[model samples]
Target chain A: MSLSKQHELHTRRYGRNVGVGLLLVGVIAIVFGLTVVKVTRGDYETPATTTVQE
Target chain B: MTDTSFNSQTGTYQTEATFGDYFALLKPRVMTLVVFTAFVGLLAAPTPVHPFIGFCAILFIAIGGGASGALNMWWDADIDAVMKRTQRRPIPAGKVTGDEAFAIGMALSAFSVVFLGLATNWFAAGLLAFTIFFYVVVYTMWLKRWTPQNIVIGGAAGAFPPMIGWAVATGGVSVESVLMFCLTFMWTPPHFWALALFMRKDYDNADVPMLTVTHGRRATRVHILVYTILLAILAVAAGFTSIGGPIYLSVAVVLNVLFLRGAWQIWRRDEDMSEADNFLTERKFFKLSLLYLFAHFGAILVEAGLDKLGWGLWA
Candidate 1:
């Protein structure tokens, strides 16, 4: 292959690498984000309030 | 019929290796240190990360370190072939092509940084990205061929892993992170110079301008001693911080004293002596250098444990 063609191929390969990397990151992020949202929400109710004599 | 033709033909076959061959290209020993130190950084941070995020951060950092090694091997193939220590490395030995190594490195580098950023935070991911770039582009491609100071500046790339780990948890830099960086940065010159002193012939044959090659063995000896003093000071100082405690202080004191003594032995030697005498000193110091960093980082983990137990001396 010509040097330019070789360079082009490598560049394309690098792009593919980046794409895979992004996909992995996206998968991780979705799971993490969902967990964070759930944790922060009012899904777990506060303990029932107890009255004390003044 | 000519040597050039034979060389070109061999180059064509350099990519023929199986899975194990590529695995060897990652420089596993260095990766181990990177992973350990980065893990320590993550654990030592004031803020806590979800366990899963923490694990992913460390995994990405290890991959980033491996990526740097792969890229370094890709760029340094010529010198690697000439050096006895590196001659059997995948690229140098024709087990992998430069293109293949480059591809693997670039791929891993991207994967490590981007995923780490997403799984944890962008700050850590950005640091990983820069570390890969600095090691490959700045250190390997530009500096290695051009200057004797390559390792000194390039050392920052290696030092950044722990800092990246710190960022993963805290999402920013702090005094503790800087201290961690200083420990590795200061440790590097002496660690590498000792090896250079012993492997002067390799550098010379490869025409790489290591300190020993450019300034003579005496200068390299003095340089090692100087860096060792600096490293000792930094190591002990680290023991006084929030990250430090009785365990780390004790570990640092013992390791630093032994390291200084080793450096003194290396410095005391005359260059005109036989290889049996001189090489022995360099070899011992080089081995000690590896143990030195391992112990120092291990001490940091100990300190973190003490802190968690509410029994830290420094705290």
Candidate 2:
């Protein structure tokens, strides 16, 4: 069989494969969105009110 | 890869388990209840969460709940196959194997817990972990088949989502969260016993020791009435708590009256009478139970909304 030929696994289990593919994409979107929100809210920033005097 | 198109032993197309079948293993209907209660819990809290955070919190909580459901299905496949209601489940129907179910359950369990902890507070994550354990290990494994009081104690597992939701906001338990937990806990028995009443002979054939199976049908009816009365008290009293307001109290009072009336009607009938009427009252009560929980939570959500608008009684 040629390398470009579609495997039976892909064709037979199309729904399962597509579902998993979409789920992976959804996970990426959620993680990216959460990161953006956290960054914008300064959830990880050092406290501005704190000071150290030598 | 290797002729993964058939279930040789079952002689069915099990290997081709679709996305829907895998989803079915999660018991989506039960997940709806979990997600709704968790959302109510999160929104009802005094602290406001970021919208995205709140959404993620509820989603993770629901996935964790579904993971527990999958684990329960894996563990209870034998009895599930025997029961008419559960016979079409993925495991029982031969669409998925027990091992696959367990794997999915465990993977999702870990993913949901870790992400929930990262997204919210560890306290809420811990509660989710415990809820999963209680449902799978304690309730399903130990309590369900061993005793007829299974659903009574196992009700705690279903009742924890709201508390977990509250923790997502407050990072700890509180009187209001406990009240929400109590509402669901007190409501589970009558709801399930009604199911057992109408779905007669299901538990008997499964040998699962449900109240209807272990106790006589008359005893089941009496138990339903007693539990209904107790549940009405709890549901009504919840309206006076911090989570409650005028709207909640009104909804609670009306629903409890109708619920108690349904239970009373159920209590007055014998098996012969129930059979003659096709278990109409029991079935009706069962349907009403769904509306009962949703309305109570809906009322609470409304009161929370009203509080935001400064129109709430306690505002």
Candidate 3:
């Protein structure tokens, strides 16, 4: 069946769905923010020992 | 995807688990203590952390605390169902089941620990992991049912958040973190025992070995008085620490005096007087205890902030 209306299940679980959706979004934002900060601060930078100096 | 419960009397499948029901699994009130103390711990440290990193650190710490709460609820579902205070919890009220609580708890526990390690440092992450384990396995599963000294020992679980917060910034433990931990650790027994003082029957009915239940309420009263005196001394002494200054000392002196007075009032009253007064003193003391803790931590946070501006301390 083609989707035409909100399913009873969907309506019943709407609040929980919204909450889960928002939480997932928050997780993504945190991960992305942490990454940008880490990279900018050179937290992931390698030590000079990683380079082979002849 | 599907969480449905069938009611035989109603002849319906009720979608009883709301977003709030799931949220309740996380004992949000306890998480507030975790968040506040951890935030204070992080800020109170000598080292400065990046704002975003600090925020993530607190968030992960709170999630770890909430995860442990869920686990505690799962383990205590039986006792919680019987206890009036805890009867409305998600599991006991039948809003969520034990298995679901356990799964969410485990998932969040692992997620929080891994994220904390990445976001801050592995030392804090490991402390968070130990806190979750201590609250769940040591406190909930083992100590809670087995000992009348449950709150004394299990209180350590609640006290770990600040230390974890300090760890988030300093990447190691120190005297200040230990002091903060001890403040909460010492405070827990009297705070909870006063609760047990007034709400005596709940523990007796639930068969949890509260000091009021195992010892007589008379003994519990003496215990409260003793612990409070010790707490007051510790509270005032902590004011001289590096975390403290003029404002902190003032807050400490005033609140500790008040807290000692409340504890003394509790000790002096007999049960007959207590029942006649409807536990007014115990209830008032309980209320003050909340303010007592928050104000102490708030003073610490203020000191930390002022220190940043080079105007923090009395000395």
State what share of the real interface contacts each candidate retains: 0.00, 0.64, 0.93
**Residue B155, model 1, lDDT:** 92
Model 1, range B225-273, lDDT digits (tens) per residue?
Answer: 9989988998898888888888898999999999999999889887665
**Chain B alone, TM-score, model 1:** 0.95
Please compute DockQ, using alpha carbons, for every candidate against the native two-chain complex.
Answer: 0.05, 0.78, 0.90
Count of steric clashes across candidates, in order? 0, 0, 0
Question: Can you tell me the CAPRI class of model 3?
Answer: high
DockQ score for model 3, please?
A: 0.90
lDDT of 1 by residue, A1-54 (tens): 655545554553564466567767976785676467446754356789999989
Candidate 2 runs further than 4 Å off:
A1-4, A47-54, B1-15
Candidate 3 overall Cα lDDT vs. reference? 0.92
Clashing pairs in 3: none
In order of DockQ, best first, we have 3, 2, 1
Q: How well is each residue in B1-315 modelled by candidate 2, as lDDT tens digits?
A: 564556654455665689998999889999999999999999999899999999999999999999999999999998988899998999878889889999999999998999899888899999999999999999999999999999999999999999999999999999999999999999999999999998898899999999888888899999999999999999888888878888899999999999999999999999999999899999999999999999999998999888877788864
